[model samples]
Target: MSGTGDDFKWFGEGFDGFPKRLPEDVVEYIIFIINSKLSAIQTRERLQGFQRALATLEKKFLKEYIWQRESIRMDLVCDNRRWFLRGTTNYGDSVADEWLIVYFLRELSQEFPDAWIRIYDTDGEFLLIEAANAIPSWLTPEVAENRVWINNHHLCVIPVSDHDNPKSLAIEEALSIINDVPTKLQHLPKIEQEAFYRLKSFPSAISENQHHATLPIPRKLAYILRSNPSYIAPAVEAFYLRDPISLRLLQPEKSRTQLNFPPESFVSVSVRFTKVLYAQLLGQQWVPPGPYGEALAKLISKESGVPSVSREKAEIGIKVTAGFEMLAQHKLYADKKATREIQLLLEDIEAGDEALPSDDEIARWPKREDNEGWLDIDFVEFEKELAGKGAGSTTRGFGDKNAQDNLRKMVERFNKFIEDEDAGLDGAKGLGLDPMDIDNDSEAPPVGWEDPEDSDDSDDNEDDDEQADKEFEEYERTFEKFLTLSSAEKSALLDDARELAQVEEAEKEEDEEIKKLSEMMEAELFSHGALNLGAKKNSGVKPVMGDGEGRGKAKLEEFLEEVDDNDVEYLDEDYNLAENMLQAFKGQAGMAGPAGNLMSMMGICFPPDADTDEEFKNKNKDPVNNK
Candidate 1:
């Protein structure tokens, strides 16, 4: 039965050394060992077994043995009771220490069936119950006959003479001695009162709705006062509670350590003090506190401004009057200012006034002029001209029908001259003249020449006849030489000669007017600078006089520059010209110049005027005009 301090060690060690300084892992391991060693039934059996063993050991052990074992047993029982006590404390039960109170209450309930009793004790000794009446009629008969002997154990009942007006003197005495009464209830002294008025008043005193009306002081302060009534009662009796006015006027200086101010009246004081502190610290009007603090303070102040039930209480009578006034002022200003702005806006809308047109709208509109002070050319006309000539049709020509007919006739005559030269050379071969002889005899008539015979022309005839005879004799000799060849050889030679003649004819014809027409076109384009000669020959039919005029170019440049310098309407005459010019050069080879210039004009024209054409022109003009 004897044991050393180690026997008591396991009590403090906890189920797994949970309350002692053991490592968590060791504690867990011990818990596992304990659980493995005991099932639910075995755990209950072990408890009963230990209790029985303690009773037996207490009787049989030596004095020292009894002391050590008793210490261990006491520690074990205390630890177990503590575990159960925690489990029951929420329902106001003390499993180990307060069982007697519960037992007494149950017994009294049975003895006095029509009434209930509440017992209060300070040190777990003498018990006192406040009863509505004496013992029940059933119990009074047994007590009068002395058959119940209730005083045998710790049951001592001192009966009241007047059961209808039972006193709480014993209950109060018991309550006064209980050391563990909550601090809020410790100072109430024992008093002799038959009706228990204080207990009856407890419920109403604590009800939040009734606290202000029935309590002499603020609920929070009264609560403090009641708990320490000994200290507060004297002050209440002496009428020494601090003046509310003095507290209201008191303003605590700002302290960095304290952030919260009393919410009701103190908000303004805090705000004003905060402003002063801010001005002092940062040399400026008040800025809000840190983000979180400002948010919380704002919420609290906003709530304080609204009336609540607590506000009706004298103790919490402080109101945010100034804060509300300031808020009202701000709201009034905001509303008035907003109303004025709305009125102004409505007026503007009614008057049909608007800000300037957006840039995108202006961009989408047509253009006018460029920077060079030239009129924008109508590219549509140029495109029409180009389209007409590009098809290579004579209908697109510049001159009237008569002029075109004359030109056509000249081309035909030139072609006929080439055809005649070819025919002459072909006939020379048929006349028995060597085509080579014909080529060499450029001054001679072709081989078919013969003079008409006249009867009186013998003298002139002699000269003519002599020339003819001589030419014929020479031609016959050349023919005989040509005829001396084999038929096949002559035929072959003749074929070769004919081909040479035809080639020569073609060369002569090509040398005639096609070359002339080409040169003329080149000259025209070169002279007027209407078109560049270096332009591809396939460049569509030449620009005529009107189409190629320099006047259009001058006008275009002038219009573009003016449009560029001024804010002219998009559909203005100049803008149409620029737009047409832009369209003209979209796909054609010659359009690049006009297209680029037109786009440049469009960019400069639509925006607000940065510089004007007159200014630019005057700057470039003669000094007399500049003056």
Candidate 2:
């Protein structure tokens, strides 16, 4: 490992000796990984297949392979308004490879501001997860399946639920729907915009290409730490694991790399450090080293507003503390279960509940004995007021007697309406004849109508129509029971019956609609099959001589009719023969396979004798064969 030239020192002088070329297997693996990420950014075509491909790669390779290489390449192509990424790695290579990919993609985003580019690996979507809490309320996993996209390096959600359609079609339709609507970063929720900007600032080291670290470290790492200084914490943490002999790589004797930092400042710096640590743990190609530990000690002193410690003993402790805190933060975000638990805790806290309730606590919550007082209080004041209102309840005793008489008259009037419902008379209007008007008794049945013994025709009618008599008697008994209920109870029962009838009618209509749709689809399928069958059958039939174009039309109609009559039954027999014959005599048309062969074998197949045949032969002559 020799020092790289100044022009090639992307990772700075400290990383010059670091390996540039990875092992062949590792190179191949990283290339595949890079290509997979690029493929997702390129196009939405076969997106479901793309997801499956990524899953297969992760299952088969990711766990086994180590990303030791510090270089990567991309093969990109552009179609009309879209970029396509090929699964090859020939488009030159760059150092700080992973960041370089992000840099290049950001540049592409700037170039094609309208075009959406999605970049994701097995880790999940890069931009969406950062602003997960701020996504739209309607964005469920199913709705957001293929709608997550990036336009101009800003996260934009296409709010449509079209998971049933192909990914390509869904994307196209979604974009078209919102084509005229401008989506700006400022339009996003405050928290979401903040997240986007934070992520945007993380890649500034690569984008700006400037070094900011005060120590004599690699230029590449200097730029990265300059953009997000907390990244140095993870590097310092990794440096601690090295053996004493490996410390020689730091070149401590070099005057240019020397730095002094204090131990007490580590506390404040650790408190201010990023908890997510995405840049250090997931962004960078590798955990940087060399002078980063000492550099981080200096960072701690500066960030905490404490003066640097000159004592070597205090500086060592400060560096160690810095590394340990960085490692802790990195591990915290990396834990799978911690994120979910933290989210639940945050939700609880937001809802004014500091802790998640246990199952037993939840069960006991509603068992408070104080709630029993609610049952002791009377809430029937409205019902009492209602009973006092109207003409039936002016005074207690007199009103009660009038109510009983009115009820008897109302039942009689309702029964008469039911009998006249078969005629042009309206049941509702007939029942509205005012039961309180005692003088309007003309509509009521004659005296002794209720007594079977008083009617001479009752016995004769019962014997003549036994079943009708039983049904009428049953109806009368049910009506009597219905009349016994109070006004409120009767009203409630009628309302429930009306609602139930409405629900049943709606369900019946829906079922009928579904049945009709199914039948229509089946008919369409059958019709399409019939048309295809007619075409195939027509293809096998030769035109009759001298019948001209009109004859061909008649023959096609006849064949279509035949297909319609036979329907699916034709699939069993004529379909096979038609398919085979068409295939056997394809292109030749006039040459009827076995018949032509038999005629040729018998020596009866004459050469072209007619003028039309010779003219056809001359027109169809092969220039290559001159025949």
Count of backbone clashes, every candidate in sequence: 18, 1
Q: Over the stretch 1-627, how does candidate 1's per-residue lDDT look in tens digits?
A: 011222233655653442222211110000000223455555445444434544553344322110100022211222422110001111111111233223333333343332212322221111222221223322221121111111111232333334534322332332232223312221111211211322332222221111011111222222222222222212221112223322222222322232111333221111111111111222211222232233334444554333222312212122222111122123232343322443344355447663322335433534321121111222333333434322245333433222233344344434544555434744421223434655564587668644555546666778999999999999988866874577579769977998999999999898887898767754543343433223332233211111223443465556557664355444243344433332334333443343344345655322211134454345566777655
> In candidate 1, what residue range of length 10 has the lowest lDDT sum?
24-33
Superposed by TM-score, candidate 1 places the C-alpha of residue 546 at a distance from the truth, in angstroms, of 99
The TM-scores of all predictions, comma-separated, are 0.15, 0.22
**Residue 288's lDDT in candidate 2:** 25
Flag regions of model 2 displaced more than 4 Å: 1-74, 77-108, 121-123, 162-195, 199-627
